[model samples]
Target: MGDNVVVSNMELEKLLSMKGGKGEGSYANNSQAQAIHAKSMHHLLKEALDEVQLQDPNIPFVVVDLGCSCGSNTINVVDVIVNHIIKRYEASGLEPPEFSAFFSDLPGNDFNTLFQLLPPSANYGVSMEECLAASNHRAYFAAGVPGSFYRRLFPARFIDVFHSTFSLHWLSQVPECVMDMKSSAYNKGRVCIHGASEITANAYRKQFREDLAGFLRSRSVELKRGGSMFLVCLGRTSVDPTDQGGAGLLFGTHFQDAWDDLVQEGLITSEKRDSFNIPVYAPSLQDVKEVVESDGSFAINKLEVFKGGSPLVVNKPGDDKEVGKALANTCRSVSGVLVEAHIGVKLSEELFLRVERRAASHGKELLEKLQFFHIVASLSFAL
Candidate 1:
């Protein structure tokens, strides 16, 4: 948009702050998604806690949640874990150990908002120190750390559990090759890794390998032997990495169409559009398995792929305006900051506004058809 407009080092983190102000508009979608998906994993989650060693009655049970965004969406997952652990203690007649949980995200995450929202009721019987004091159960303590999950976040062998959801798909950064003007891998129109050049595809694959490996390596160090990590995140289809079966049908086509319209309106430069791509990669089931197996740190106990669930906050199912606004707000939460960094704030807002209009036209039926393949893995540290 201007010579002054450049991608700052902190821009990505700022973008993830969710609509910039301390408002509810941006984080509404991720919060909703977390609620829906957290329920689906209830059965698998319980099974994961079951595998975790419970013999020690006095030691603190530590759990670290990676990419925990700024709000109750995070608490929802923690509630699930604590609930299961409570059940385990009850069944075994074992003394409940102190539960220390850490919520981690990029330095830019709105952890202030996260902390403000952490009332006991939001914790699902997990966070109220007083409530637990009256009983025999050990208290649950929650803390926030700001950092990237691709690097180490805690001391070696100190953690008992690690959980990440809807977050690992993000690569550390977009591939350098795609943005270089001199490079052959210039992504002309699309924003994602799908349908890119061989060079671009290979670059993404290589980056994903390194990122996933680093993620596993760091976690392996922090997690004790027999510790568990349960991850639920986006994954590509078996037949094709780009085609998410019908998921694209529900949401992708409309999103692209709206962006194309913005280009036609001369809002965003073609050069900028071509060079800009999301830093996310939804790896295939095979891709995830290979990386986990090769890491030699964690033994895969369970790997299940399933679709996304219904919208939580969005009331009406098929209402075009409501659906469109919900979808637009969701994308705006994660990508809006980055878009503004490159295209200038005005155009970025306009772009997603158009996306809302476009999404509304698709109706809820099509949106429901959107593909959301998830990889729910219960991994144990290799002893």
Candidate 2:
């Protein structure tokens, strides 16, 4: 691994320590979301596995979930694969093959949290003897490997099936130029071209392209010949380069507005804003295909963008009044963390109150414009 790719043990410890705190926010609910994603990915993988079994009856199967935060998703994936293998065996009148699972994530991921969630051998119905004899089943989890999906993390032809959800969009880090707070074009809290110049926008685009290319290249090596990979990540739509009235605009504007408010309140300095960039990039569907094809090893099986509605609206069990209350509660939970982290403990209460007032004034208008895309891409290629 290159120096930039290395994640030290100390850094991993620090990240894990920060895993469950006021600022954790949506990340704390990753387990819940992973379960939902696993359900969707299961069918896709089963189909791929069936295709593979048709070619080789007693082939060993291995599945790897990259960027598997805390390994919650890994367990669910393993459950699905095991069930699928059993069904495949019964249908084909052949014995089930041995299976191995690997969970890969940033060195800083909370592996302890993941391992704690695992059930002991008692949870597996088969006795140790039966498990050993009937199937060569093994499951393993590892962390702190690295974050670059564009680079090879595993040995060549090692992974049989690769899966990731909601994790691929995170760039390794913000572009280096953006890290310099002294740049004249820097707009601390805003990401849109309104506060930023065309140059900044183009710079972001370039960095995104490089990152996307790297992600595809890395996946090419690990996936075995004819192995399948699945990815579901945030995506954006292509607008006229000049037209800024879309999902990207809305998300950028909201985050920028929030940052601007904090800056005006003297919670975060202008210099800090210039130096910080949200480490997320939602590419268009065309952009995604371009990057994947650039690698030349993978063929796209499906690429569909589905909107999951506005991310801001919180719906809970209740009438309109109760729904509003639930929304408020959810917003408070989110804003509270943002305030404490981006602002400070001394101003967290006041900042959260101000944010609530601002949301009350414009939340609905904003939600109408806000959109999230769920892009699922399945790929297969020869070794």
Candidate 3:
């Protein structure tokens, strides 16, 4: 009967570790988009890493992959980066510096599951010094920093390469104002803002501004001059938030439908339904530029839009079941826990099932593709 998003981003992240889409896990079922994106962007990632090496040579190359979720995709991405840096220097007739790769996420992230997949977990809540002890060049060291990227996590000018993918769209939390019943911004009957209302859109945009500002400011202090940051996260095609054709809107419609079923069954109150909002935003390119330019910490090298949905939406349009599975898994990994907490696990499952079925039935109107703004930057200044 209360809003599940009332908690802070730190708290939400803690609750999500168990629910995070992990390798060989439920959430992983629909992360093909993320996996593909990682490999596809290998060249981009390498270019950034290579640039870092070219600029700063013979020093420990500290690489941080913020929000590094568990699985082979991360491993493959890290492997490419590690091997590239090593080979680049080797080909230039110089010894490769030690590579210290830091995998960061919230404290609640499944570090145990993640470390077992890559580096050994020598200890909990590790630091750079401890991570360095275990790292060897041919093998590089790996450490996990468990906390919000919204805050500064590394020392000033200590980082060389900063990379985040499929992350950053998650704001620290839903803008608190969206919950006020008297506020016109109240996103009634919607599970996410998704540009459903102008007030709601403005509220989300404001939150994104502050969060991105904090992120850029912190990273500016942490990275050296000319340091590179490659970010690939979900973003919108235009400045308008009300574009209703994206997957966020379509799936949210099904989420509402799911809640409607529960309301009919007297399982949840309309007040509760109207009070909730997802703690994330798919920002526009303009939004990112405004934050970065205003911060005066980085110079934009390149920015591009990436398709947000699995290409399968177009390739297998006739196969509703397959399309449904993709969309369902994506929704499940993101909001499964929130739904279970507020609406009950059984109803949560039913909600997604209803969505899957609905997707299956309306194969034609189910073209809910989304996109991301892939922006590349180099540190120009710092706070």
RMSD in Å for model 1: 3.4
Per-residue lDDT of 85-190 in model 1, one digit per residue for the tens?
8778888888777777799998777787787767653333455556465444435678888888888999998888888988887788777777777878766677
* Model 2 global lDDT (CA atoms, 0 to 1): 0.54
- Give the alpha carbon lDDT tens digit for every residue of 1-383 in model 2: 21122222233222322133223233444234335544655666676666543225456566777776653556777667666766777688876655556666666555666666665531334344555444334332222344446567888877777878766655565555655557654544564433355555555556667876777777777777767777877666543322223335433554456556766877666654444444455666776787777778777777777554444434432233433332333333323332344345555445344444555565555455544566678778733
List the pairs of residues colliding in candidate 3: 308-370
lDDT of model 1 at residue 207?
79
Give me the displacement of residue 220 in model 2, in angstroms. 1.7
Candidates, ranked, TM-score: 1, 3, 2
lDDT of each: 0.72, 0.54, 0.68
lDDT of 2 at 213: 77
Clashes of 1: 2
* lDDT measured at residue 288 in model 1 versus the true structure, 0 to 100: 86
- Worst-scoring 10-residue span by lDDT in model 3: 369-378
lDDT of 3 by residue, 245-338 (tens): 3546544666567667766777667776766667777777788888888887677766666554452333576787866665666677666766
- CA RMSD of each candidate after superposition: 3.4, 6.2, 4.4
Best by lDDT: 1
| Model 1 spans with C-alpha error above 4 angstroms | 1-4, 8-24, 120-129, 133-138, 244-252, 310-313
lDDT at residue 103 of model 2 (Cα atoms): 64
Better of 1 and 2 by TM-score: 1
